[model samples]
Target: MSTYIRQIKKNVWKWKNENGIFSVKKYPTVEQAEKIRLIHKELEYMEKPFILPIIESTQEDFIIQPWYKGDHTVSYRFKEDRKAVHLLLSQIHDTNKLVDWEDSNLFYSFNLISKWQNRKWKMNEISFFIESHIGWEQTKFLLLCGDIALRNMKPFNMEKRTLLHGDVVHHNFLSDSSDYKIIDFDLAVIGPREMENILWMHRVLPEINYDIRLLIHEFPHLEKVVRRYKEAMMYPNELYREWLYAYSLPKERKQKFIEQLIPYTNKALTEWPNLCYTLSKL
Candidate 1:
C-alpha cells in the first residue's frame, strides 16, 4: 500500500492511501473529540447536497474522517453555491431536535449583545494602534458602527434556539461534483439559528459588493429576519472582526493584511449609508 502525507493546517494532517484520503485533526481533549463525534452522528443522515462527514475513528485526542475532495464554495461566484450552503445550513438547524446540546458545556447559550460589547471593548483597547495603521478616519468610522450596532442590537428569541454552526464563513462549505458538505464543527454551538444566518450574510455581503437588495432577492427566506435586524447589519461587524484578528498576527503579516484591508475599509465606508438605507426600506 502506497501512502502520502501532507499537513493541511495547524494540528490537522491529511493522508492518502490505496483505500482513500483521510484527515486527522488533533482535538484539545478526548471529551471534545467525543462531543464532535456525537454531532457527526446526529447529522449523518442529512439529505443530499448536504453530505455529512464519515468518522473513521476517534482515539486519544485524534479524530479521523475521510478527507472531502473538493474546492470550498468560496472558490465559486455562482448563486448555486450560496443556495447549497443555505440549504445545508437549514437542514442542520432543522435537525436540532435530534440532539440535546444545551446540557453540554461545549455548546453553551450564546449572548449576542454581550459578545458584541466584548468585541467593541477589545477594539477600543487597540484603537490607537489601529488608527496609526488605518488612519483616524477609518478607525473612528468602525468604532461608530460598533456603537450603533450595539445600540440597535436586541436579544434573540431563545424559544427559537437551535444548533448554530457558529462560524458560517464560505470556506466551511465544500463542493465537488458528487457532494456539497459542511465541515469544521470546532466552533459549533447551540444558539438562535438566525444568528448563524446573520453571520453568513456578513461573510457573503462584501463578496456581492454590499448590495443589500441583491442579497435579499437571492435568499428571500432571509428578507423578513434580515429586515428585522437591519440596524444590527448596518454595523460593519466583519471589518472590525477582521481588524481585531489581524492585530494578533506577527508584525509583518499584520501589516500586509492591514494594507490589503485598506481598500475594503474605504469601500465599506463609502457604501455603509446606502446599504443601511436599502435595508431600512426592505
Candidate 2:
C-alpha cells in the first residue's frame, strides 16, 4: 500500500511505496497536463545540468512523477544554492524557444506593468485596513515604494519574451545531492527574464539584510539590470505582498503574521531611503 507523506497543496499529495516515493497531483485538466508535458519536453531537449521530475504516468485527473530525494534549497547553504539557481535560470532563459500555446492559454505572456498597476490598485483599496493595523507611517512607506517601483518599471517588451519559471521562492528549489532542481510550474508563464530575476531578488534580499551592493557583487550579471531599474530594486515588494496576503487570512492567523511582519516592515522602512540612494548612485 502507498504510505501518505504530505499534502503538497489543496489537491496534491506525496506518497511512498516499495517502488519509492512519488507525487500525485490531482484535478489537472487534460489540457493542463498536455502543457506540462510540453514544457517538460522542452526542458529535456535543452539537457541543462538540472533535474525536473520525470512524469511516470498520468490519468484523466491525476499526474505522477517519481519523487526527487532532497531538501528544499532553504535547508541548504544559501550562497551556493543562490549561485546555482541563478546559473540554472540563465540556462533556462538562454534555451527558451517560442511555445505554441495555441488555444489552451496555459502559458500566457506576462504583462509586468499591467500586473503591477493592478497590485497597486489592490493595495490602495486595502490601505485603510492595513494602516489601521500597521499604523499610518509604515503603510504610507509601502505605498510610496509601490508608486516609485511602478514609475521606474518599463512596459513589457513582447520581443524579449522567454519561458519564466514564474515562482522563484526557495521552497520551489530542491537541493538534490550536489545539484539544485526547480519544481512546481503551476505559475509558469512566458515573460521577460528580468521579471523572473526581479521576483528572485524580492525573495532573497531579505536574507541578506537588503544589501544591494553585496547582491550585485554576488551576481555581477545583475549590475546592469539593477542600474537600469533602480527603483524596482528599491521597492518593498515582498513586504507589501505579505501584508496584502495577511489581510486575506483569518483573524488569528492574520494577527500572528502581523506580529511577525512588524519588525520586517520597520526594517524596510528604515533601510528603504538608503537603498534608494545606493541605487541612485549605481
lDDT of each: 0.80, 0.76
Error of 2 at 248 (Å): 0.7
Candidate 1 residues 181-242, lDDT tens each? 88888887777888888888888888888887887898888998797787767767788788
| Window of ten residues with lowest summed lDDT in model 2 | 95-104
Clashing pairs in 2: none
Q: Which segments of candidate 1 are over 4 A away from where they belong?
A: 71-76, 103-106
Candidate 2 stretches with Cα past 4 Å from truth are 1-8, 75-77, 97-105
